[model samples]
Every structure is written in C-alpha cells, then in structure tokens.
Target chain A: MSVRQTATAVRGRYQPRISLWWWLTKPSYLLFVLRELSSVFIAWFIVFLLLFVRAVYQGEGQYERFLDFAANPFVVFVNLVALAFVLLHTVTWFVLTPQALPLHLRGRRVPGGLIIASQYVGWLVVSAFVFWLVVGW
Target chain B: MRRRRPVEPLVWLLFSGGGVVTAILVPVLLVLLGLAFPLGWIDPPPYEHIHAVLGHWIARIVLLGLCVLGFVHWAHRFRYTLHEGLKLQRLDAQISLLCYGLALIGSVWAVYILLFTG
Candidate 1:
C-alpha cells in the first residue's frame, strides 16, 4: 500500500464525523446544552447588575435612568426569558450537587433529595431576606 | 512529543464551585431584580438604599466572586460542549485558550468595576 493510502486509512479510522443534531437525540443531552447556554444569560444578568451598581455610584439621576432602561418592555421580556433559563440552570445544579459532593452521615450515605431540598430552603431564606431588604424595608 | 498533565480534575473543581455559587445565588437575584422590581410585585428600593447595600465590602466580594466563578463555570461547560457536541477536539488548544481567556478577562473587568466604579 502507498504511504498516501495508509494515511487516508488511518485518518478515516480515527475521525468519525459527529452529527450536527447529536444533542437532539436525547432529552437529557438537550437539557444539558440548554443549561450550558443559560450561562450566557446569567452573564448578561451580572453585566446588568454591574451597570446598576455603577449607575448607583454615579448618582440618583443615573440610577433612575438605569431603572427606566431596565423597566422597558423589551428589556423586561429579555430578562424574563433569561430568568427562566437561569432558573433551569439552578435546578439542574441542585439536582447534580449530591453526586458532586457526596456526604456521609453516621457512616451511611446521605440522600440526594435531602441535599436538593436543603438548597431550596437556603434559596428561600436568602430570597426572603432580599425581599425584605427590597420591599419591606 | 511532550507530555501534558491531566487538567480535567482542576476544571471539574471550578465547574463544581461555580455550580454551587450559581445555585445558591442566581435564583433569588433573578426573582428580586428581574421579576419583582419590573413586574411591580414588589416596590423597588430607593437608589440610596441599593447603593448603600452594595457599598459594603462583603457584598462587593460576593458579587465579584459570583461573576468570576460564574464565568469560569461557563468557560468549562462551553469548552466541553464545543469539544464533544461539535467534535472540535482537533482545535482543542485554541478553544481552551479562547474560552478560559475570555473568562479571565471578564473576571478581571468585573472586579475592577465592582471595586473602583465609585
């Protein structure tokens, strides 16, 4: 066999083309892709938050303008969608946490459900505190 | 050929830490800043109040940490997505550099803005 033929054979054996729609084959895979995509929106939220902080640091006028921009219908819609995606990301993170951080209590393994539930409880407590700071203050 | 150290475990550690930060903090932030404030479900706080809350050193640190780790988390996930989903292992070096480089730059900018925006 020619060297060229051998090289072609080796390349063909080593590199199989992956399909573009590979993620669509399974719901879990699709969900994983979406969760990964959610980070973009989460990053967007962080940018917006940073802008808010900068505006606040500037003065009341800048802060008001930032609030107005945030309240615009288009911005609100984008934020709403981003919120959903981020929530999905958060839920998946919690669901996977028990596997990531396996804990043993009294020599037995802890249940995943309890770990996830505890995260939810912590979320609630933090949210309630923030809610108070925002509205109840 | 030179040998390379396995970096998967280090990347996984960052991914896990970022996941924990996002899970604990992102939802409440969304509910408060994204939904309630705009939807009128709750009265928005005054600018002075919001500013005061953020002026605290601890709040600034938390925000910086969240943004940095969140970006790192993103870089690691998207790196694997490009590698496995798109079969870009041939471009692995370039892809890793771009993804993690962006994360590092973003984290630095976030910290700078958070610290010096006053």
Candidate 2:
C-alpha cells in the first residue's frame, strides 16, 4: 500500500468518539466547563452596561426607561444569575492567578494564598472607591 | 494539510489580559450594578451623574477597552469549549474564524457606539 492509503487506513481504524455527556463524568470538568460558560453572561453584562451608558448619554427620559427595563423582575433575575457566574469567574480567576503569574520575593516564590489575598484587598479598595464616588461617603 | 500559523500566542495573550481585566473589574461592577443598586443595598447613582461620568473621554476609553477585551476573552474560551466539548476539531478553521470574527465585529460595534452615540 502507498503511504497515503496506509494513512487513510490508520485514520479510519482509530477514530476516537467523544461522548456528549463527557463533562458530566467529573466534578472538576463540570466546574471548568461552567467557568468557560460564564463568559457568555459576562459578555451580556458588558453589553448591558454599554446600553445603560448609551441611555444615560441620551438624556433623562431614556435613562429612566433604561432603569425601568433594568428593574423589571426578569431583568433583575438574569442579572442575579449573571452575578453568580461572574463571582465564580472572579474566584476561579483569582485562584488561577498565581499560576498565570508566578512572582518571587527574596528569591522565594510567592505563595498562592498571598496572591489571592492581595486580589481580594485590591477588589475591596476599588469597590470602596467606586462606592464613595457614586453613593458619597 | 493546512499550514499552521503562530496565532495561538497572540490569542493567549489577549485571553490572559482579558482575564486579568475581567477579574479585577467584573465583580465590582456586578456588585454595584447587578446587586446593590437593584436591591437598594446602595442608592444607584443619578442618571445625570452617570451621564457626566461617561461623557468624559477617559471613562469612554476605559469602557471601550473593557468591552473589547471582555469579548475577546469570551471568543477564546468559547472557541476552546466548542473544540473540546462539542468535539468539533474537524471544523477548527471555521469555528476559529466565526468566533474571533464575531469578537472583532463586537469590538468595532462597541467602539462605534461609544464614539458616535450620545
């Protein structure tokens, strides 16, 4: 047999089939899949934010309509679910940060806990600043 | 066989940068806009104030960057999810083009809205 024919035979003999329910087989795989799925909701939130900004820029009446739409029970529910996914994304991202960015201090690698703690602190500081700006101290 | 390009590095770079940005900002935005404001845990900012803030060039630029990077992040992740979860390796080129193409379109649309819209 020619090389092309042999290659074709080998490919035909050993094609691996993936199960549709493969993600359901393991808890960690399920979580990873969920983390990836969270990006859709994150994108939705960004789209909503952009729309809200546009409405605010349009003027008071438009902004009021945007608020009413946002305050609708279904919208609020969707946002709530998106919030949960975003929180998951945030936590998983923070936990993975140490691996993504390995830092060293005094020639010793920084611990993962320290990296995560710093992220939480940074989050608190930024959240506080935004809160102060919007709500006033 | 199709020639392979060195695009993975660039995509991974955007993915990491977007991840960092999303991690730092998404939670804060969610808490304020998603939960606190809606639940009245905190009084939402007035519309005029929001308008004023978004009117600033800096705010517009920041938002544009966030939206663009966020979409890029989604594109990369979803591409992999389709490849692995759906076992679509046979259609890798088509999937890659579709996913990244949409992200590019979204980023451009976001920029246009931010620049042209009120």
Candidate 3:
C-alpha cells in the first residue's frame, strides 16, 4: 500500500534462490566439507570397532549378538555410505595432502598424485602387518 | 567430564597410528563381522574372537583416542567448509546464525564423547 511496503515486496520477490551445485561457489570450501564428512566416517568406523571391543569384553555370547547388531541391514547401509565417504576422503586427501605437507624432492615440488600413491603404498605396508596380526598366515 | 584438551603425546601417537590401523582393520573387521548379516562375505571376523582382541583396557584407550582425533579433525574441517563452501556468507545474519550454532553443537559432541567415554 505505502511506498515502503512496495519496496519490501519488491525485495522479497527478488530474493535469490539456492541451486544444488551452488555450493561449488567455493571449491576449497566444498573440499573442506568433504574433508569433514570423510572424517566423520573415519570416526564412525572407529566407533564400530570400539563397540566390537566392548562386546568382546562382555563375553562370547554378547559378542555374537553385538556383531549381529552391527551387521544389520541398517548398518550395512551405513557402511555403504561410509564407503562413499572413504572415496571422498581418499580423493580429498590426495588433492590437499600436498598442501598440508608440501614436500620438495630434489629441489622440485613433488606431484600430488605421487604423494597420494606413496601414502597408499605406505598404507598397504601397514595393512599387510594387520593382516598378518589378524590372520597370522 | 568436561575436558577440552586432547590427552598427550601417547594419545597423539595413538591417533596417527589409528588411522592406518582403521584402513587396515575396517575391511577385515567388516569381513569378520559380516557373518551376522546375510549380505556379508561368507568368511566373517569370527566375532567372539575378534571381540576378545578388542575388549581390553588398551583397546578402549586406543578407540577413544582415535575417535577424539578424528572428531576434532572433522570439526575443524567442517568449520572452514561452511565458511567457504556454499558461500553461506552471501546470505544475511540469520544464515550464519545456524552455522555457528552447528559448530557449537559439533564441539560439544566431540568433547562429550571423548571425555566421558573414557
């Protein structure tokens, strides 16, 4: 009705909309969020292990039941989601690891992919040790 | 019960080591735990035995340390992500209101789980 009311209405009508990909406004930010999300998965995976340990402490029967609970369909779905997060974390770490620990080998900046591969290789070595510990074969 | 600081160098060492351990353990643990679910691999982790391995005081310590480190890392990462990603900054004061609120909640969760669990 009044001029002020008309201006307010015009501004409301012209409010911006949020697009799905609009989050890409800051690629770094997106990467950061992905980093957080990935870490959350990493956290959850740890929690699951902790639960496993707790169940074991309770005794064999408790352990079996807890293990079953963890393996439920809901958990499987959660694990799948975590799998997606692992992929996100792996990619993000590769992309940003270089930044976190910028290495210069022989007076040249090492490649990011190379850095990531090196970490993967290192992880494989650790995994082998765990495999040995757990399976002992 | 309301401690905000991480434990110590021992804890930090445990944290660093834990990530590598998780990468190694999760798949195997998954396979081992899979027996409970029909969809899991036929060869599972022999639940009771693995539980025996994990149920020690030492195991609990390791898990708690790892969870705290992982959560702290996640919170710090998310803070920057929100500030940078989505350009939530473009919006008015009300938008940042929720973002800050979430950060507080995340911090509280991290502190609560880490301090009280152990």
Candidate 4:
C-alpha cells in the first residue's frame, strides 16, 4: 500500500480502462472520446435521412413534416453536436492519417505531419471556396 | 527481433489516401453545386459530361474502392487505438469486424446505387 507499490499494482491490474476523470478533464482526451461519441450524430443524421427517403416515398406533406422536425431547437442542438463531431473527426482522422495513408512519390519517406497538414489545407481551400460561393454568389 | 512486414501500415496508407481524397472531393463538389448551380457560375455539366470526368469504369472502381478502403481504415485504426491507447479490450475484434463488414456492405450498396440506379 506504499505509493510505488500502489502504482505497480495499478499498472499490473490495468483493466482496459481509460480514466473517466482524465477523459473529462483532459481536453484532447475528451475530444477523442467525443469523436467516438460522434456515432450518435451519425445515427441521428441517418435516421433523418431515412425519414427523408420515407417522405419521398410518401409525399410533400410528410416531407414538410420532416422539415418541421428538422427545425426544432433539439434538432439544432443535434446539428451542433454533429458539427463538433465532424471537427474532432476531421482533425483526429488527419492526424492519424499518417498511419493509414503512407503514400510516396519518389521513394522518399513521406512525413505523416506533412500528409495531415496537406489534408487540412485541402479542406481549408475547399471550405474557403464554399464560403466564397455561399457569401458572394 | 524480426522486422515483420508492415502490412497494417501500408493498409493505413491506402485508407488515409482514400479518406482524404473523398473527404476533400465531396464537400467541394457539393458546395460548387450549391453555389454555381443556382447562380450559373459553377454548373455541374450534364451527367454525361461530368460522368466521363471520372471515366465510367474509373468512377465506379474508385468509388467502390474508396468506400471499402475508408471503412477498413476506420476499423483497423479505431480497434487498435481502443485496445492500445485507451487500453480497452475484449471487443477489439468484434468492433473491427463490424466496422469493416459495414464497409464491405456499403461498397456493394454504393455499386448498386451507381450502376443500377443510373
């Protein structure tokens, strides 16, 4: 029960647990966990998408109802969650992307950092274009 | 220690590339369609015109390839990270199989949507 002994014991018995407290307090940890929670957003989006499909099969009134359901504050909160999910998803996805997409053009070792940065840059350009269109056009 | 072939790493690369490309291409195309379609600044040419941008054969192949690869990437990375990083266990294989399985099914579904629907 001494401190070192306790540390050893905890490490020895580590049981597939990440600290809930740590996850709560740690910004990146919470972000990563929140990214995982993004499945909720995915599910909500899909359910509504399914509703749209159903409405298409049904008629305009059902589609309007679908729109109505979509406009609720709860739905807006859900979208906000989805946006946060996407942010975490994108950043983490790119950061880890190094492990996934190790492409090389001339037998050079492509740095993961470069890959991730490029991906984000590409996203930024595309997003800027979208913003430009949304605002200007 | 034996240096095992880095199969997982290579697979990760494919996953990353596909994910990145799709991640970039999709939103841009969508936005362009949204803005340009309405204002006549950016128009998606006729399906016939646009379809050939990615040749018929290439488009289908790439789409299926991307869908399958991206999901597999998600599966392998997520499972391994959960197991090693967060120290989660007991469900690694289950999660991996489930995610990858969805990817496979999704690939087939996408193929059907593209080829048969069109």
Candidate 5:
C-alpha cells in the first residue's frame, strides 16, 4: 500500500465510542455515575463553606447577608439537591470501601460486611461528635 | 532540571483520603450549616460562637485540609468522568490541566480564607 493509504488505514482502525448515557443501562452503573457527579456538589459545598467563613470573618453584617443569600429559595433548592447527591456519595463510598481497601486480621482477611459495618460505626461516631461540637459542649 | 516524581500516587492518596473524610464529615455539616441554619430548621448559632470556633487554629488547619483534599479528589474524579465516561479522551491533556489547575486555585483560596482571613 502507498504510505498515505497505510497511514489512513491505521488511523481508521475501530475505536468504540461510549455513549454519555451508557451508565443508565444498569442501576449500579447509574449509581456509579451519580457518585462521580456528586463531586460537583461536593466542590460547591466547599466553596459555599469558604464564603460563609469569609462572611463570618468580615462581621455580623456580612454574615447576615450570607445567610440571607443562602436562604433564597433557589439556593435552598440547589442545596437540598446537593445534600441528596452528597449522601449518595457518602453511602456508596462506604459500601465500596472494603472492595477498595480490604482489611486483614491475624493471617485472615476480614469479612467485607464487617468492614462495611465498621465504617458505619465510625460515621455515626463522627456525626455525633460534629453534632455535639456544633450544638456546644 | 531536578528529577520529577510521578504525581499519580499523590492524586490517588488525596482522592481516597478526601473520599473518606467527606463521607464522614460533610453530610451533617451540610445539614446544619447549609440547610438548617439557613432554613430556620434550627436556630443559628450566635456569631460569637461561630467566630470562636473558626478562630481556633486547629479548626483552620482541619478546614484547610478538607478543602485541599476535596478539590484534589474532585479534580481527579471529574477528569476521569469526562475522559472515559463521556468519551472525551482526545481532550485529556486540556482536561487534566483544567481540573487540577482549578483544584489548585481552590485550595489556595481555601488557605487564604481559613488561615489568612483570621
């Protein structure tokens, strides 16, 4: 074959295209995609938290303004949606933790279910601590 | 030029650590600070109380860690989501640059707010 034709043939080799909606084919796949998408909301929450911190740093007036902005219906709705997505992220992260990082106990691998349950226990403890901290000593 | 170390390991480290940290800490934080206080589901804490917690250096460090790891995790995950999931592999270089660049910028802003603003 001519050099140009050979180069063209090599470039024409089959390359499968993944559809954007491919994750929708299965419940688990969709959940995985949703988990990935949750990063956006996670980033949003971080930005929002920083803004709130800045407002607090500036003074009561700025903090009040931040609160007023946060209380807007559109902002509230978006945050509610973000909360749901973030919860999904949290649950899925814990459920998959064992698969990602398995534990061992004295020459035997720990049970995946046990590892998952331990994550929940840890989550509960941390959540409780945060609650206590926020609400006061 | 000095020898360069591969960054993939660091990226994965931050991603895993951020995943665990955010999973445990973020939900309740969002509920209380993002939703509850704003929506009046609970009374807002007094400004002095909020300020005192933030003024503490430990809290500032923890928050800085959270923001740095969180943004790095988002950058890594979103880069893959766009490259593989959405079939944008041809734009991989630009995507990586954009993702990690924005993450770096966010981390810097977080540091400024958490550390310098006080």
Candidate 6:
C-alpha cells in the first residue's frame, strides 16, 4: 500500500467531544431531548396498562387495589409527568410524520400542514372512540 | 443475484406504526384511566364493563398491537437517543441488545398477559 493511503487509513475522522448535557444548550435542543426521553415514559405507560389489565383479569378486589395504587400521590404525580411527555411525543410524532410519509395526490405532493392537521383530526376521532368504549358506551 | 433485505426498514415500520397508534390512543386513555377514574373526577367504569371490553377479541388485538408496537418504537428511539444524544456509539452492540432486549421482553409479557391472564 502507498504511504499516503496508509496514513489516511490510520487517521480516522475527527470527532469533537460532546457533553452529556449538550441538549440543554438551546430550547430546540431541549425539546428534542425531551421528545427522545418521552420513549421511556411511553414504555412506562405500557407497563402501567399491563398491570391495570392484569388487575382487571384477577377480578374486582385486585382491580380496586390497582386503582388505589394509581390514586396514590406519588403515582399520580409520576403519571401526570408521563402524560406531559407523552403529549409532547404525540405532537412531535405527528409533526414529523409528514416528512416520513409524504402523501401524493395526482402528481403533486400533499402539503405538510394538511397532513399534520389530518393527524390531529385522526387523534380526536380515535380519542372519542376510546372514550365511548371506556366510559360513554 | 438476490440482494439481502435489511431489517432496518421493518424496524422503522414498527416504530412509525407504534408512534401513530400510541399518539392517537394513549393520551385519552391516560386521562380517563390514569387520572380521572383514579381521582374520581369522573366516575369509574363498572368493573364488569372494563372486564367485558377487554375480554372482547377486538380489544385484545388492539392492545396487543399497542404494546408490541409501543415497545418497538421505544426501543428504536431510545437506541438512537443513546447513540446520538449521549454519544454512546462505542457501545452500540451492547446498547442495541439492551434496548431491543427489553422491548422483546415487554412484548412477550404483554402477549402472555393478554392471552393467559385477561
């Protein structure tokens, strides 16, 4: 191998050291970080739902106990925070969806705003359906 | 020659599917079940109602989709978060294993609970 080729191969790209709290530097960065962090809470919500379902499966007594647990101040606080993060996740997910799944009609691409607005419409419809199933129905 | 298909697009499909499902369903569920029902802001549904709803095949399928896709979504995002946000790419293999491993376990647990328990 040529000496220049050997030198180039030996020296890799320079990567600047980044701090762990780099996301804190700007509002947008923080928002991005929070959106990423929302995944953890999403996982938490799944676990919460599983436990609730299991409690329901076990019967009335267990279900009541689960409700009591959920009603605890700490659990309620955690859930409130989780709700915030998940809301952020929903907003960011929908906004970004336009980029990931661009829709086309005829020959032209669909407007991003239209896609995002449709997502909100879908969210409302889905939420209403769930409300009907869980409470209204 | 037949080219080998990459697993990434499938993973991203699960991720996006999960994102859309959870985005639409979770917030209201959280408000109703997590907050309102527990706090008595709204009357809790009858245990029979909840039980009956969950017992239905459709509810089971929706829930299974939610849990399975949700975890896959979480796995993909959290994996990228560690790699990019925290700059932990050096531990890529281990990180991928840990994130996706937990997702797998969570999905299995959801399946078991959905199938066997309730």
Model 6 steric clash pairs: none
**Which candidate's DockQ is highest?**
6
Instruction: State candidate 4's TM-score.
Output: 0.52
lDDT per residue, candidate 2, A31-78, as tens digits? 999999988888888888888878887889988888778878898899
Q: Quote each prediction's TM-score.
A: 0.88, 0.90, 0.60, 0.52, 0.91, 0.92
Which candidate comes out best when scored by lDDT?
Answer: 6
Q: Candidate 4: which docking quality band? A: incorrect
lDDT of 1 by residue, A1-137 (tens): 75533544688666455588889999988988898888778777877777777788788998889878888999899899988988898888888889978989999999999988998998888877866765546
Worst 10 residues of 1 chain B by lDDT: B1-10
* lDDT of each residue in A18-104, candidate 3, tens digit only: 564765679775665665666567666656655655556556787678757876889877877776776566555555566767899
**Any residue pairs clashing in model 1, and if so which?**
none
Candidate 3 Cα misplacement greater than 4 A, ranges: A1-21, A24-35, A105-113, A135-137, B1-38, B55-62, B81-118
Error of 2 at A60 (Å): 1.0
DockQ of 5: 0.52
DockQ of each: 0.52, 0.57, 0.23, 0.12, 0.52, 0.58
DockQ result, candidate 1: 0.52
Backbone N/Cα/C clashes per model: 0, 0, 2, 5, 0, 0
Which portions of model 5 show Cα errors greater than 4 Å? A1-11, B1-5
Model 4 / residue A29 / CA error / Å = 1.1
Chain A (alone) TM-scores for all candidate structures: 0.87, 0.89, 0.67, 0.64, 0.85, 0.88
Candidates 2 and 5 compared by lDDT, better number: 5
Model 5 TM: 0.91
Model 1 chain A poorest ten-residue lDDT run: A1-10
Worst 10 residues of 5 chain A by lDDT: A1-10
Question: What's the lDDT for residue A2 in model 5?
Answer: 49
